[model samples]
Target: MKHLKTPESLLFYMMLIREFELKIAEMFAYGKLAGTMFHLSVGQEATSVGTIAALEEGDFISSHHRGHGHMIALGADIKLMMAEMFGKRTGYCKGKGGSMHIADIELGNLGANGIVGAGIPIATGAAYAVRYRGGKQVVLCPFGDGAVNEGVFHESLNFAALHKLPIVYVIENNQYAMSTSVTKSTSITDLYKRACAYGISGEFVDGMDVEAVLETTKKAVERARRGEGPTLIESRTYRYYGHSRSDPAPYRTKEEEEEWKQRDPIKQYQRKLIERGIITENDVKKMGEEIQKILDEAVKFADESPYPEPSEIFEDIYA
Candidate 1:
């Protein structure tokens, strides 16, 4: 099926992303999920939801470490995703991938990478493959602000630009890269300007505004399909939690965090829809209940699912 562009659908997807990540965070807090490295994109749901909404059915996406929202945006099964996080055999990667390594090629998800900036090249390769096959498909590569400093980012962008690859590189600039703020890491502000170095189109977006992201990405996607080139999009967003479960995020002041939360994407969008008469407070309550029920089932499924057997360890290893 094609993208869901309706206001209701868009808002619903954003809500789904929020609830799913929150559930994971809750599970992780309780030590129910596997592994310790869990990154939550709670405040950045709009970026994932809107960017994916701008894509065509045949288009592919390469996601970074904080990629749960990307998969959820593409309408992935929450139960299987939760199972993967639980390291159960029912997961996409048969439980080996854990939270950071789930991949579903059939869904046109090239996969989610644990390494920063690693997915950029994968997306570039997918775009190149699409171009080589003479297909109209495009690729969306989403990474964090920290990934911009990685060497692979520059290399991938240069290659994509040179070949006019059909890819959109989105920097989910949450201002901070781990503990370091973007300002401290980079010399200049407005990361999208880096696109000039590669000679491709660029967009600076409000990651909190889902519709803005959708409209901006639509133009970029259109350009790529016209055989123009890759586009670099810097969607400035935020994270409601620490980098992972370990970091207490002592660096940022309480006031700063509160300021960001004031523009919470889900709440903002819900208000917008409510004001426009597209949805009422009751509608939002019902939607949350629906998503919560799905999440409940996901956790139950993940808990009930079996873990991978020791003997089958190397069965799916291609590399």
Candidate 2:
């Protein structure tokens, strides 16, 4: 997608993401959703909305398990997404992929990976394809802090740096890898420093700030387009919900979650836009109404769509 030129547009995309995830949560609570593996990026809206805004239309992204926000920000159709959530045949992967494996190749979303740290290699391979074919398209790999310790993370970055592959890696460091805190899992909490070992530029950004993520990712995206090597960006962000619906987040204190909510990305950005005269309270209300209508239609479409037949199960897979 082209860079979002205005603040209002950015806010609209972020609002779309915020609503989509909340709707998913609502569906899960009502037992209307298909699976229990859904991961919601509720508090990390700005990181997704901002990072995707920096990419060109030709670029590709390999998404992590928690990637609904990434896809929604990158212009996914809500109707199809909702259909997939309901496990209907009208979905992007014909309901085969569900929430964790959604992909639309035409849209440059390589697919969301369920295995930890797996998408890194997928993005690296895509970048290699671009370099091999002499294509201008770059690839963005967005994963979590948990992926940093995986062997593939090191291997992929080492190769990308060695060959100067047109790729950018952003770690959505939401402070925990499931229940395990980063402080307990890694030797250094400053994850951007890991990029130094690969001889690439690394920077940290406040993921709560949308513009900051955009600017940081934009520089790296541009650098990759210029045939410069990869970059590692640490987006310091959070998740409002537990790792999954099944988790009550006993590991997280209510006090800490409340503190992080104080810097809520969507609320903060909306306030900034209103203060800067880029939007108004009326505009926000209108945006909400419009989004509600669109989402209602999405839910209707999903509910009416049929599930795939058992006979079609062997079709998409290769022998």
Candidate 3:
């Protein structure tokens, strides 16, 4: 097993993402947020934190609509993120990108795309840029299972394979594409196998297990750094919320949701850490309190921050 950082740090990051997302949900419900739509990756914290833990500072990432966890895991400021959600000028995009389009270019985040499967080709192009400049950076492209059905998915994968681009295509297969299940949407259940069609390696991972995700992504990252080209990783995860803020998620059953909850990544990792004597229950509680305090301050900052002026409406727009 590769030394994938201390278990304590991994657990902390997972908790941070979970708490941040949970707060976002609460804020949205109270009309504290300005956006009309929001997507939460509540049950998918492990996949985001674990995969990102294996990356270096210079590495790049492209995110999907449910991408807050991805940005938080990548060291984004919670206050700024919350400010953006509230349409404040302190946000990463000067309050223009909102929740779905936040990007910190200085941090190597290429920004999250609202369109399905749009980030795939963007990541592929970034990888090509890395290769051309002989840079050691590798790009991680994450999207939903629904994105696999998009034409850009095939085109991007084929082009990356042909040119040996330094990227990893991480498929966050959260079972449902909005209300439609993967079974109803695609004939190929094994999403990773689609990588073979483009002559690249692929692997499936239990998205709830942070350790598994970290180990698997580490190998893929190492391969890309070695100039071995892209690898596809299909992480089977679940979303605890609807596709957006207004979605009720009536398509799934109570039992199905409960079953996935039992495998809650944060709880599972907490158990493992306690079992190994790495941390006590008190430590876990303390960590939770600390994260909660951070988020509380973030919300306060966002609430107090000024919104973008009406005169600035056309400033950031690109013709």
- Best candidate (score: TM-score): 2
lDDT of 2: 0.93
Query: Top model by lDDT, which number?
Result: 2
lDDT of 3 by residue, 170-208 (tens): 999999998999999999999999988988999999999
Write one digit per residue (lDDT tens) for candidate 1, span 227-292.
999999999999988898788899899999999999999999999999999999999999999999
Clashing residue pairs, candidate 1? none
> Per-residue CA lDDT of candidate 2, range 1-319, in tens?
6636678878888989899999999999889889898899999999999999999897999998899998888888999999999999999889999999988888899989999999999899999999999999989999999999999999999999999999999999999999999999999999999999999999999999999999999999999999998999999999999898888899989999999999998889899999999889999999999999999999999999999998889897896
| Global local distance difference test of model 1 | 0.90
Error of 1 at 294 (Å): 0.3
Question: How much does each candidate deviate from the true structure in C-alpha RMSD?
Answer: 1.2, 1.0, 1.9
Candidate 3 has an lDDT of 0.91
State the lDDT at 21 in candidate 3.
79
- As for candidate 3, its clashing pairs are none
Error of 1 at 224 (Å): 0.3
In order, the Cα lDDT scores of the candidates are: 0.90, 0.93, 0.91
TM-score, cand. 2: 0.98
Query: Candidate 2 — which residues are off by over 4 angstroms?
Result: none
